[model samples]
Target chain A: MRKFLGLVGAVALLAACETAPTDGANANASGDAAAQKLGPAAGSAQDFVVNVGDRVFFGFDQYNISADARSTLEKQAMWLKKFPGVTIVLEGHADERGTREYNLALGERRANAAKEYLVSLGVDAMRIKTISYGKERPVALGHNEAAWTQNRRAVTVVTVGAGS
Target chain B: MKFCVRFLTLAVLLFSSQAWAELRVDITQGRVEPMPLAVVEFTGDNSDAAQIGAQIAQVVSADLERSGLFRPIDPKAFIQKELSMTTLPRFGDWRILNAQALVQGHAVPQANGELAIQFRLWDVNAETQMVGLAYNTVADNWRRVAHIIADTIYQRITGESGYFDTRIVYVAESGPANKRVKRLAIMDQDGAKHRFLTDGLDLVLTPRFSPTLQEITYLSYYKNTPRVYLFNIDSGRQSILGDFPGMTFAPRFSFDGTKVVMSMARDGNSDIYTMDLATRQTRRVTRHSSIDTSPSYSPDGKSIAFNSDRGGSQQIYVMDSTGKNVRRISFGKGRYATPVWSPRGDLIAFTKMTGGKFYIGVMRTDGSGERLLADGYLVESPTWAPNGRVLMFYRETLRGEKKTTKLYSVDLTGYNEREVITPLEGSDPAWSPLIP
Candidate 1:
């Protein structure tokens, strides 16, 4: 029973670390106060995504939705249900590992995978648009796996909603 | 036009009579040591023509030297001075200076304000003239005249087509890596007369010269949407290509210049498509769900080579012009992309990524005899010179916290790899055909 408890605690810690920023730097270094002003508001598109996470990452050269990605989309679906008039744009990206054109296509596949998952969870297919930036726009500048994992992500940007 | 006719006549006569000892250069051995040659100062009739004569000789010397095939000896080493075009050169004198070949020329101003340039190539060992030719062109075209002269000499010795009279179109990048401003730039093959065609307000990539060498096709981020665009370099006019339902990029002109083959993304699938520039008819080339892009038409215009992920990883594949008989051509260990068919129709240049390194390589059309020419942290987009003997690509290096990109070229023998000087960070170079 003690070993079982320790195992559960380790699993819980791993889960928490997965939710943290992949890069060592804090994405929100200003803390909750500045985040509140610039952050999403309640009953808003920004609020729905930010409060429930707006993006999901993939392994190198892999685009299939992982278990963590599914959970993030589940929260996104629940939040999306709160705002019916909101239209979202799924912007897919890739790490700088492949050619430009191939990466662009890979990004598109990732974005569509997320869009299909959202549609499966009762979101309107017409409300989501997909765009792939390929390896062009990388948020993480490092050339290692840590930065790559963060760069290979599909971001759910609320294009038309309360914030707009 | 008369000048052109006269030039052709002189070339024909000179080539037909060349049975003398030939100065053959074995390029397959690579640039272990450049062949040494001597170019005497060309004489001119007037002070103005004299200045042009000196400049022409200088340009010719630079062209041959840059090829890594010929090394022009210093004029200070010449024992013979100002040999007349009609007289034979003192071959023993040139041989004494360790020059295997000698070039003598003279420029004369014509009555119509055009310039007449005459030159002869001599084999120092055999003490005989290998070939002789003359050119008549407008005074303003002295540079091109020099290039043509250099081409003739290059062909006579190397027995390969020359790329001296060519141009290159590339992307000029500036600013920081986070916010790079790119412009479409063009210049002579020797990096002369460099100029930007675009305002840098829109991001441009992959500028390829059309078959006619009068226009260029490239991708642009216009209005925040990536799309293919065509620019009339001669007229300085730019226009967006045909509209599609979604984003379109990676455009290349057909070998015949009648159509453009590119990639279009729709419904989460990116596929290859070609449009007839004459009729404005769009046709789907590949219907596979895989990402098919970077299509390059073969030199014969009968087949197309492109990069696709349908094989589970990015590799090169070839198909007929109508998208039939598709077959995978790259079976190497790493991923291959940007398979550009060489102008010689003998090899395909591509970018390969493996073992965390990027390589610029070439392989036979059937995917055999793969040879890598350059490797770097990030190198891609291989473009071929008109002669198909040299390749130009960009290399990106990561330094601590900064990344710097520059243009580089390498010959087929994997030697003579050198950086091509650009005013700013350069990428995606397209070599133009030999200018008429």
Candidate 2:
């Protein structure tokens, strides 16, 4: 449980050098324009979705977190730790390939896996809630593997409101 | 879903096959040549009756044609076009076109606003009246009358009960793959009387029918919290079925419609549970850390077949009613889900995913004699017709196009596959037993 706590403490020390698909700089840039209209206030839901990396992807039909997801989760934990009063809801989703009911259960497994990681990172378990949408709500629209890779994910939604 | 046969059993096999050639449709064997049948336009005593009569005959013909056991000969092939209620059908004319059977009927509109339909099935090869029956229903229920008539003819010739006069409750999907709007929809076996049960405000899935009533148990994303719900189709009323502390889903009615068996996820792990309808009491049926879901009851309500990943990958497992004697039933290469017990109590239908492909398959109760019926890009949720001879599931296209889901049914032989027409894209179809 103590393995990931304070492991990636220096976000600025890494200097945003890597350029993975989930790189924070790239996502922040996309959310920047919308941030102006949507108001990505510090510790706001918009800020979490745009800057703190509120979502992470999984492999096909696999709920185990990937190495890429670790950096995102680390950022999410840092944001949650900074906002002591802000509670969050984690939503797990699946690709469209699996059966309906099993996918529902699988999505729950993914969300709980993320919750467990957050708890391991020192986030309060009582402050976090989880839900599974299965394949009902998808972020990607295509029928191919590329879209599915994006759809199989867990999203962290800040429930503490933007004004906070 | 219990069918109410209102008509008296007016049908009787009057003649033995020894006196004439047997005009039976052999349904047990696979790859059978459809028996040629001629369904005439049912006559009427009045103009209104004539129009309704024609519609009824068309519905009956469509039902028979879709079964794959009967090929309705075109009306143009009929030598005697004018079929009357009292007069016998010209068996010689049907024999000329090689039609083994001929059907003639008449519709009469009663003064009490009721419609009565009388029909006769003649074995053309035998030149004898194989069966005859009459049905009286409200004028608005003429469609159901047609279905009942079709069932009668099918049973008389096939020597097995019919699957017509049934209904299907499914999630009707619209919009794009990412923003699909799913609503509860119901229709007859032939896709008639289509109507939406839900307004699509909340996401819904996997609507299943009670074997004994006009009730459906399903999973609904109401108030953004997923749970099992029960819907009374007759009253347009809905209620949450399980008031558990955790998420409840994948619900199915017990054979007697007295309880709902489903999966509940608590602390991230899912396990099967059964809730009695009378007492609103729930009993945990499976205790495991891994996922245990998609519970279905055997016809006798003695055992249950469910999908579980306790063995590391999804597979079918069987356990007694008390959740004891747990045994894995599927030993296939791919992951299995949705193990639906057949009404006949001898087979279980399932969806198997292997080698990146999906299949709707069936196997014996013990999981032996596994046979794949249909395969495609995405196929799942296999439900049985009341007769247990046909299986219905939904399919999706996942390549070279925007993904789309639709309903389909395949018989046991696997040779007669047909798409069930719907108003929109459909998925997670649950077939009701024969409707009375």
Candidate 3:
């Protein structure tokens, strides 16, 4: 009878531990889950989705892929390989400090750089189309360093077949 | 004798009343809207004459309406008694339709088989002959006659020269990013008759016309080296203006077409420099560490207005042709660039940036009465039409993920904003003087 009572007490202790009153920890876990939901799907087999804040730095006015950009692109390529049906549009952008025509050319180079990197990583070149918005479209409207960093980027937007 | 005296007294009283009692309405502002005008079909002596007359009239109507300052009212709405241009206009009929102005013309095939078009403008409110113009051109030159008629009407009403006979030279862009193909493009001011001057082998920008309207000077990135080049518009022949080693940009011809002023960069700094076209001699106009570009000569060619960042930020400055008497002109609450001195020499126009907003503004030479004429997400490169009464600039609008840039123009009065139609995206418009 004492052993049976001790077993019941042990089970009760396990239940207490499982449903402990760690409210802050539970809230944090839920918050992380929400963020995961909001973020682009990872480990997808189809196409890779680049978030807006993802940085794609360039060497001056160049659009050539740097080593740092390659690693990020490799991760993107892995996701794209998983999703065979997904397609992406690589959008190139430029900072506001240059002439309009030159910046347009620079933006195109940046987008093409990202696209070429993705292709080199085994993603289908045909799956990626590139366009340059030049300095006309700025993600950040400020004229400071933060805005320039944001503006000088290329975003990979994922799309399904025939639709967005 | 007593009856005559009484009649004279009455006539004197009537004349006095008419002189003093004329309706004095102060037109401080008219509808910034285009003046609605009616152009009836021109009557001709023969069927072919009538056809040519109608074509000329249509051209005139199109020219006026395209200017954005005049809205050629639809002739379909006309209740005029006669559609034929040969008939005298019934003033009462035009007045009933509320047309502020009426244009009527006649085309006749001369004995030499050429066309002679005569037109007249009637101020409906004034009920008098505003002006009469005549044009003689070959059968193929009917369009020219039409344009001339439009110019007459425009000049009579606006008290300014018409830009109908002008052309714009701009850089045409195509191809994907990184490998852009640029060509020199010229088109009518209304954005028609587009022709690419270059074969897209080099990159070109900031094309300007000489006062004679025959020569163009612009910067070309040929063989990866940027230099100023001059091209004869009529012959399509081009040559490098000066043998400069570094980058040369923002080029403009002098008023007499005898010199070229541009910004040349060596090392990392840029300064304004001028080259005598005949002698190929170069002279530095400004010796500053800051960026000094977009140099424009005054109408008299004695002074220049340009933008420089020597004052910690970009502002406009004026200096003599010899690079003396340098003074700051713009003191507004913004960074100003691209200062273009008007052909009229009354005001200096510029592109201003403040609080992340771009503006096209104009100020007197003394930098007073500064007025922000237009605001946009991005508006740059303000070029004056030949008349100095209108300004053409480019605007860009941002969509969700796409951005589009187009050309637009506005009158100096802060009225008449209109889009110039182009087949592709266009910017950096430079208006040429009227072709002599």
- Report, for every candidate in turn, its global Cα lDDT versus the true structure: 0.84, 0.85, 0.71
- For DockQ, the strongest prediction is 2
lDDT, model 3: 0.71
TM-score of 1: 0.88
Off by over 4 Å in 1: A1-40, A43-50, B1-17, B28-32
How do all models score by TM-score? 0.88, 0.91, 0.70
Model 2, range B60-121, lDDT digits (tens) per residue?
99999999899999998689989766666677888899999888888777787877787888
Q: After superposition, how far is residue B307 of candidate 1 from its true place, in Å?
A: 1.3
Fnat across every predicted model, in order: 0.47, 0.82, 0.00
- Weakest lDDT window of 10 consecutive positions for candidate 2 chain B: B12-21
Give residue A155's lDDT in candidate 1 (0 to 100).
84
State which candidate, 2 or 3, has the greater TM-score: 2
Candidate 2 backbone collisions, by pair: B3-B436, B4-B436
- Candidate 2: residue B257 lDDT (0-100): 89
Q: Give the TM-score of candidate 2.
A: 0.91
Q: In model 2, which regions exceed 4 Å deviation?
A: A1-39, A161-164, B1-5, B8-21
Candidate 3 clashes: the total is 6
What lDDT score is found at residue B166 in candidate 2? 89
A1-164: candidate 3 lDDT, tens digit per residue: 24323332343344334443453365674776774554434433111322221235564445567665676677677767776777877777888755453354456558877887878789998797665555656655655565576567777766555222
